[model samples]
Target: MTGWIESDRWAERARELRDEGWMLMDLCGLDRSGLGRSVVNAGGAGTAGAGFRNAEGTGGLYGPRFEVVVQLLHALKKERMTLHVNAAGDPPTVPSVVEVWPTANFLEREAFDMFGIQFEGHPHLTRILMPDDWEGHPLRKDYGVGKVPVEFISQPLMQIDSPGQSPETVAAERSVDELGQSGPPLRTVEEG
Candidate 1:
């Protein structure tokens, strides 16, 4: 099951669950900046995952810009729980659960690397995936989608100048541009 909790009560609730035999499995960040985007169609055909609703069920985009999602597991009982905590302000932040689970060190670092969600009280919070000089959080929805183009090198076919020797003497020779195209001439001793 999943439950959304306030940001201020995040560490408090996490501690409660830990005492109840819950172990932190993973923690990640979310960018809900443009949740209003149409999930069904880009042109806004239907409303499924878009639009923000307040605690009172009123509709608006006034929700927090970022959120932290955590997965918890009960070791012996074999049960799971999902917890969500909001992170607000110009630079969103949440209390680190590293104290509760040492494994959260890497998870919270990854969240910070990808989404720029600060984990307060973390021993050494730094970029875990991206380089230290990286410009912005790549996983955020507001980040621009950049792409690099690839180019292919064309190779010409080799030729066997020896007469009486079949064209297949070179064992599957072909040109990169087109089959049987002229390429670098390979002179044979038999021709001399």
Candidate 2:
């Protein structure tokens, strides 16, 4: 995609930019099949906040337009760059911008959390705020309301050995036969 866009005849010369480098950085959404249409950021990347979005689905500039991305790439030799995704959808996958800028760690993780975009080369990928058991990326454009189901099961209240006594330990003083027969269920004043 990067190479093709840079070679576009019409788009190459239109935007006045010396191609620094092309980045597969920014991600917009996640497609089950793979990455959907990418969010293309054009020239003036670091200097200014501008992107290339051909809205109306007609291959045209929508908002603040700058240099044709292709033109920018023509001037570069072989240096890393940044691709800034504009609108991320469900499960966005932005390539690691860390190679160019290691500072992208937090931002990329944030993008992963909110947009479900994964950075392929990210060293660590874990939920920052959400619990370990959380399901579904919460910040997607089409967030689903379904949640992970919870299951309840029975287990021993306490182990045989322990230093300090916990509620479970104190409760375990009584035998199972005595629980429903004559003794209190648990946590009764008598047990405490």
Candidate 3:
């Protein structure tokens, strides 16, 4: 089951769910900046037929730039439900659910670290995955992507430690000249 809740009523709704024997299974943030345009322009292709509207009933498809998704589980009942809350400010801010569910502490912090979603009233909302000095949210759609070179390490074809297998056995089966021709050529950084 899934439901959309207004950002202003997020914390209140979360408390109600908790009192109703629901456990916070997971919480995450999402960037839905341009999704409304894409989905609306795509006509019925991307529409889920569930007709989503903002708090003001403006008929906006996606509502906001950021969203906070909360998954709740009724363990004894073996049921699950998801709540989506749109964060509507510049630096998307949402009320913290840690007061209702202590387990949401780190999860909210992670959302803050990755998507720049601020959890208001959090005890200590700091970056959990990235360095404290990290500039922008890494998972944000508009965040600049940095290009880093990746190095691959070459490994031997056969395991020398395996039973009935040794360096000598491998050498006898395939000579160095044959191995060089069969294996891919190793290239230096300059070559790349």
Candidate that would win on TM-score: 3
Look at candidate 2 and give me any clashing residue pairs: 15-67, 15-68, 19-72, 19-73, 28-88, 28-89, 92-117
Tens-place lDDT per residue, model 3, 24-115, is 98999978765653321211322355553443453553467788888788999888777778888878999999999999999999999999
- lDDT per residue as tens, model 1, 1-192: 555677778888888988999998888887876765311112121224344344354233235778888888887887777666778776788989899889999999999999999889999999999999888899998786753233464445456767776777653553333333455446468863
TM-score of 3: 0.65
What does candidate 2's lDDT look like per residue over 1-192, in tens digits?
A: 232222123223222222333433332322222223334434443455345444454254222211112112333454434422322222333345455545556655665665566566678767666776766767553565554344453433544345676766556664555223423345646763
For all candidates, what are the clash counts?
0, 7, 0
TM-scores of the candidates are 0.64, 0.35, 0.65
**1 or 3, greater by lDDT:** 3
| Whole-model Cα lDDT of every candidate shown, in order | 0.73, 0.42, 0.76
For model 3, the superposed segments whose C-alpha errors exceed 4 Å read 38-62, 147-192
Give the C-alpha miss distance for residue 134 in model 2, angstroms. 1.1
Clashes of 2: 7
Worst 10 residues of 3 by lDDT: 37-46
Q: Is candidate 1 or candidate 2 better by TM-score?
A: 1
